[model samples]
Target: MELTANRSTCIGSGQCVFTDPDAFDQDDDGIVLVLRPQPSAGDELARATEAVQICPSRSLVLSEQSA
Candidate 1:
C-alpha cells in the first residue's frame, strides 16, 4: 500500500501517531511526519491504514498499490 499525508491539512493532533507511532511522528513544530511512504510489509500496511483512518483532519491517505 502507498500512504501519503497532506501537511497542509494536518493539525498535528497526533491521532495518527497515537494509532501507530512507528508509522507516524510529529516534527519539532508538532506537525505530523509520515515515516513510511509506501509500506510493502503487511504489518506496516496495517499501521499505515490505521493511521489514515484515525486522522481527524483526514490528512493521511492510504491507496492500494496499482498494477
Candidate 2:
C-alpha cells in the first residue's frame, strides 16, 4: 500500500494519527504528514485505509502501486 497526504487539505483532526500513527502524523503546524509512504502489504494496510477514509478533509490517499 502506498500512502500520500495533502497537508493543505488537512484540518488537524488527528484522525489519521489516531488510526495509524505508524503511517501518518501531524506536523508542528498541525498538518497531516505521511510517515510511511509505502507500508508493507500487511496488517498496516487496513489501518492505513481507515486513516484515509476517516480524514475529514480527504487529505489522505492510498494507492495500490503495481510492483
Candidate 3:
C-alpha cells in the first residue's frame, strides 16, 4: 500500500507519527510528513493502517499502489 498525507486538513496532532515513527514524521509546523510512502508488508503495513485510522484530522490516507 501507499500512504499520502493531506497537509491542508492536518491538525498537527502527531498521532500518525506517534503510531508509526518509521513511516511518518512531523515537519516544523507539525504537518504530517510521509517518511515511507510505500510501507513494507506485515508489521509496517499494520502500523500504517493504524496511523491512518487514528489520525484526528483524517489527514493520512492509505491506498493501493498502482501497477
Candidate 4:
C-alpha cells in the first residue's frame, strides 16, 4: 500500500507522528511527513491506518496498489 498526505489539508498536527514514528514524522513546522512512500504489508499497514484515523486534520490517506 501507499500512503499520502494532502499538503493543503494538513495543519501541523502531530497525530501521524504519534501513531507511528517509524512510518511518519513532522517537519519543522510540525506538518506530517510520510517516511515510507510505499509501505510493506503487516505492521506497517496497521500503523499507516492508525495514523490516518488519528489525524485531526484528516491529512493522511491510504491507497491500494494498482494491479
Candidate 5:
C-alpha cells in the first residue's frame, strides 16, 4: 500500500503521527509528513490505514500502489 500526505490540507491535529509514528510525522509547522510512502503488509499496513482514517483534515491518502 502507498501512503501519501497533503500538507496543504493538514490541520496539525497530530492524529496521523499519533496513530503511527513509524509511518507519519509532523513538520515544524505541524503539517503531516509521510515517513513511509509505501508501507509493507501486516502491521505497517494496518497502522497506515488507521492513520489515514483518523486524519481529521483528510490530508492523508492510503491507496493501492499503481503498477
Candidate 6:
C-alpha cells in the first residue's frame, strides 16, 4: 500500500502516530509526518491503512500500489 499526507493541513492530533508508530510520526511543529510511505508487511500495511481511515482531519490518504 501507498501512503500520502497533506502536511500543510495536518492538525497535530497524533492519531496517525498512535495508530502506526512505524509509519507515522510528529515533526517539530507537531505535524503528522510520514515515516514509511509504502508499507508492505502485513502489520505495517494494516496499521498504515488504519491511520488513514481514522484521521479526523482527512489529511492522511492511502492508495493501492500501481502496476
Tens-place lDDT per residue, model 3, 1-67, is: 8999999999999998889888888899988899999999999999999999999999988999989
**TM-score for each prediction?**
0.83, 0.88, 0.95, 0.88, 0.94, 0.89
The sequence of per-residue lDDT tens digits that candidate 6 reaches over residues 1-67 is: 7799999999999999999888889989999889899998798888987898899999998888787
* Candidate 1 to truth, TM: 0.83
Top lDDT: which candidate number? Answer: 3
CA lDDT, every prediction? 0.84, 0.85, 0.92, 0.85, 0.87, 0.89
TM-score for candidate 6: 0.89
Q: Which stretches of candidate 1 lie over 4 Å from their true place?
A: 65-67
Clashes of each: 0, 0, 0, 0, 0, 0
Model 1, 1-67: lDDT tens digits are 7788899889989988888887788999888998877887777788787788878899988887677
Every candidate's CA RMSD: 1.7, 1.4, 0.6, 1.2, 0.7, 1.2
- Indicate which candidate wins on TM-score: 3
Candidate 5: C-alpha lDDT: 0.87
How close to the true structure is residue 15 of candidate 6, measured as C-alpha lDDT? 94
lDDT leaderboard ranking: 3, 6, 5, 2, 4, 1
Q: Using alpha carbons, what is the TM-score of model 4? A: 0.88
Cα RMSD, model 2: 1.4
Worst 10 residues of 5 by lDDT: 17-26
Kindly report which residue stretches of model 2 are placed more than 4 angstroms away from their true locations once superposed: none
